[model samples]
Target: MTASTHWLATAAAQSVLERGGNAFDAAVAGGFVLHIVEPHLNGPGGDMVALISPGGVDPSVLMGQGPAPAGASIDHFRAEGLQSVPGAGALAAAVPGAVDAWLMLLEDHGTWELTDVLEYALHYAETGHALGAQAAAVIGTMGQHFSEHWHSSAAQWMPNGQIPHEGDMIKNPPYAEVLRRLIAAGFDGGTRQRRIRLAREEWKSGFVAQSAVAFARTSHRHSSGSDHRGVLDMGDFANFSASYEEPQSINFRGTTIVKAGFWSQGPVLLQALAILDHFDDEHLDPSTAPGAHTILETLKLAMADRDAYYGDSASPRALRQLLEPEYAHGRAAEIEPTASREFRPGRIPGLKPFFPILTADPGESSVLGAGEPTVKISGETRGDTCHIDVVDRHGNMVSATPSGGWLQSSPTIPPLGFALGTRLQMTWLDPDSPSALRPGTRPRTTLSPTLLMKDGFATAALGTPGGDQQDQWQLLYLLRTIVGGYNPQQAIDAPMFHTSALAGSFWPREFHPAGVVMENRVSPDVLADLRDRGHEISIVDGWSLGRLSTVIRDPASGSMGAAANPRGNQGYAGGR
Candidate 1:
């Protein structure tokens, strides 16, 4: 079974599964295909997080998030007269890690050759894939900037000085050649493992690095409307490698919910669960007013902690304390029938929380070019990023979220045929911040994927594609399926809501006091109840909030199921 954000990627993954490939192989194929077909959402120069659980083995994290470039420093950025990293441009790029991470997963757990796994992407890039409406719209929105400022991107996206319409055939021969070269690098008659290793080396030290660095050296237009050269160099690429790490797990309603560590925002979901666990199931039902209020308040607390404490340099003791049962009970006690509009991170002895400088008011105009790359602030739906989940007959399961490099993120590196990701925007310029701009330290990433286990076997894998809302949307699915007794499809189809009360993870770090974005499918009475409780409500269209995908396997019964979001008319689910 396979489920993904795009139908073509889903088809590609399921094709691999039908051809005797395992879950890992199918995921790799689908991921590469997403990079081709969903260029407006993700690209080869980005980051990914995968939770992999082999048959009978404990789940582990494939840590593909790259660190800041060696020359990326708070002093340098301040010297450049910037308070925050630009949301778009080479100046905000980390070492590109998504391609290397996918290749690493393929090398470690896949049964197919490197060329075989990447063939799907190559085919789409060399030939052509029909562009989706969302991609076309994004191109149209960025058309002015591309034509007037980023000419390289204009040449790549606009053919003959025209934006392609939806359903237009789009081809990327340069990216196809890039894939072909990586495949060629491995064809030295060596062992399969050695061949894959050679390809990895070539990616970090070869043309991919060279082309990206050469393009970044030139001053370019940034989100700040200033032209500046980037800090990335060849050594930054050569020093990074994707590796696997132990996953953190917490028991939730008889299921072991597993996630990545503190470096990512995965733990916020677990922390929210712990707080919700202090209440009865009635308060956990998202469909009811009281339940929704409780969930919102719980998320606010968790997210406040995320802004204060989560980063590559976070203290482990503080993280453990945040998940403690007594601590959760104490936090839950702060929730009231009326909403609390304060940014309240819990107090831990010897720890002083870092409060960010918030610049945007919900009542005022937002700063231009400050929106996260994953989703549009003015759109009906939270979009960008690409998620895939796969579960095979053998009990192996994987869930991955790939995002960051978007067509609108930075100037297109003409030779490489992709833009560098602006992930460094997640970091703060303040030296006191745990997620401060520091050389060789990862910016706290929003990419999160989850796995569920029951009785020591993998049962499900799930993920979605909203920047900060990624975990919030997934939390709704988890609550509905685990506590409300809804099936995977039912849970995914339910109305969703997320709070923007915490400091924004993207550039400019805006926050709204007591703000909530909810789908209108939620009962009108519930919406009114929330508004009456002092929550600032922004109601959107029905079925326009989340884009989640999941695949489940019953370890006890050997039965399998898959589900995908219906919001975008893009996500698809399939099984044999």
Candidate 2:
């Protein structure tokens, strides 16, 4: 079974499963296909994080997130007369990690050759795939910027001086050639593992690196409304490689919830669960007013800590203290019937938490490139990242979120046919900040994927793609499924809400104290109750909040189930 944000990617993955590939092979194939089908959401130059449980073994995190370049420093950015990392342009580019990471996973766990796995992406990119409405909508929104500033992008996305409409067949020949070259690099009659490694070498040290750096060195318009040359160079690419790490896990209702470590926002869900564990099942239900309030407050608390403490530099001791039962109860004790509007990060005796400057002011909120570029920030949510989940009959399960390098957020490199990701915007210029800009350290990323384990076997894999809201949406699904007894489809279909009360991880960071965006399908009485409690409410359309997808396996029976979000008419799930 397989589920993904785009129907085509889902079909590609399901096809792999039907052809006897495991979950890892299907996920890698689908991930590459997404680079073609969802170019407005993700690309090869972006980053991704996956939680993989191979054949019911313990899950490990595939750390595809790349670090800052050797020249990326707060002092250098300050010297350039910048207050924060620009949300767009090559100045914010990281070492592109998505392609290498996917290839590595395939080499390690997959059964097929690299040529076989890449065929789906090559076909779509070389010929054409019908562009989704959301992708077209985003391109239309960025059309003027592309034409006026990023001319190469305009040539690729809006040729003939017109924006392509929904369902228009789009082809990216340059990217297709890039894929073909990688496969060609591996055709030396070597072992499968050696062949994939050779492809990775070509990517980091050959044409992909040279072409990207050369294109980025030219000045371009940034989200800050200024022109600047990017700081990335070939050395940054040559020095980085994706690797595996132990995933952090916490028990909830007798089941182990697995997520990536402090470097990503995955632990926010675990911390929220710990706090909510103190409450009864009634308080965990998101459909009721009291339950909704409790859930919102709990998320705000967890997110506050995320802003304060989570980063590549975060220590295990601090994480352990944060998840301690007594500490969670103490934090939960702070919740009140009325909403609390303060930026409240808990006190850990020796660690002084970093607090970002906040205001009711919406700073640069209207810039299309400043936040998650796919989201239509004009009060209605459209989209952001891309996600996929797959579970095979052999018990291999995977959940992956691939984001950044969207067309709107950065200029398209002419030769490579994709934009470098602006992930550096997540780093702070403040030296004291936990996620402060530092050469060779990873910027704290919001890309998160989740896995579930029970009785020593992996049971489920699920994830979504809303930057900071990624895990928040997953939290609601877990609560509904684990506590409220809803099936995967029911939990995903339930109305969703997320708080923006804490500092945002994206560029021009802003916070809306006590702010909540929800589907209007949430009871009007409950909405009024939230308002009465001092929560600032912005109600959107009924099915516009979440883009979650999930695939679950009955470990004992080897039976599988899958579901995708109904919102946006894009996500789909399928199986044999």
Candidate 3:
């Protein structure tokens, strides 16, 4: 079974499964297709995180997060007349890691060759695919900036000096050629694994790296309204490679909740679960007012801790202390029956809390132009990311969220046919902060994926794509599924809401104190109650919030189920 944000991508995964490929192969293929078909959301230049569980082995994370360049320091950014990294530009980019990570997973766990997995992506890029409405709309909205400031981006996305209309056949021959070169690099006469290693080396040191370095050295316009050159060079790319690590998980009720490590915002879901563990079954039902309120409050508290302690430098003991049952009960006790109107991070002994100043209201910030899609609906702008999930017959499961380096994020690197990611914007300039900008440190990334296991066997893979909201949406789905007894589809289809009260992980670092953005599908009574409880409420269209998708495998019966979000009218789920 395969579930992804785009039907064509899901079909690509299904085709891979039909060809005897395992979950890893299907996920890689689908991920590449996502880059081609969902260019506005993700690209080859992005970063990704995957939780992969081989049939009998333990689940591990493929950490695709790349670190800042050796020259990207706090003083350097401040010297550039910036209080924070610009939302979009060469300076905002880190070394691209998605391709490397996908190849790494394919080499270690997949059955297909590099060519086999890449063919689907190549076909869509070289021949053409019907342009998605959202993709076209995004390109059109950003057309003026691309045409006037980023010529390479305009040349690639705006054909004949005009934004392509929705459903138009768009082809990217340069990107196809880039993939072809990588495929050729892997042809160095050796075993499959050795060949894959050669490709990784080529990516780090060959023409791709050379082109990226050259592009980074050139000055480019940024969201800060100025031109700045990037500090990244070939050495940064050469020193970077995706790695494998154990996933952190916690048992909630009867099920185990798994997520990526502290480098990501993933653990916030686990932290929220620890707090909610104190609630009764009825209060956990997200379809009702009390349940939704408790969930939102708990999410806010967990997110506060996330901003305070979740980062690469965060200590394991500190994380353990935060997740401790006693600590959770203490934190839960702090949640007033009324909504919180302040940025309150809990205090843990020996751990200094990094309290970032709340700068400006998110609605007024003009520095909000990273990889997030700025779709206008009901006079408000919203953002988007990308996600994919797969489960093969062998019970091997993979969930990956590939995002950033969107076409709208920065100017395209002509030779590479993609742009640098704006993930560096996630880091702060404050040296005292855990997510502060530092040479060789991974930005506190928001790209998170989830895997569920039962009795030491993989049972489900679930995820979504919504910047800081990723874990919050996934948490809601898990609650409805594990606690409320909702099916995968039912969980995904339920009314979604999330608190944006914490400092956003994107550029501008905007925070909405006590803000609660929910779909109108939620009950009017519930919305009113939330408002009365001091939560600042903002209602959007019923389906404007989340794009969650999941695939579940039944170990006892060997049956698999899949579901995708109907919110965007693009996601799909399928199985044989």
In candidate 2, what are the lDDT values of residues 228-318, reduced to their tens digit? 8888888999999999999988999988999999888989999999999999988999999899999999999999998898888778667
Residues 171-232, model 3: lDDT tens digits:
98988998898889879748988877888888899998999889878988888888899998
| Candidate 2 ranges with C-alpha deviation above 4 Å | 365-367, 374-379
TM-score of each: 0.98, 0.98, 0.97
In candidate 1, what are the lDDT values of residues 394-464, reduced to their tens digit? 99999999987888888899988998998999998988998998999999999999999998999999999
Give each model's clash number: 0, 0, 0
Candidate 3 CA-lDDT value: 0.86
Runs of candidate 1 with Cα error greater than 4 angstroms are: 362-371, 376-382
Cα lDDT computed for each candidate against the true fold: 0.88, 0.89, 0.86
Q: Can you list the residue pairs that collide in candidate 2?
A: none
Q: TM-score-based ranking, best first? A: 2, 1, 3
What is candidate 1's CA lDDT for residue 219? Answer: 97
Give the Cα-based TM-score of candidate 3 against the true structure.
0.97
Give, for candidate 1, the lowest lDDT window spanning 10 residues.
Answer: 362-371
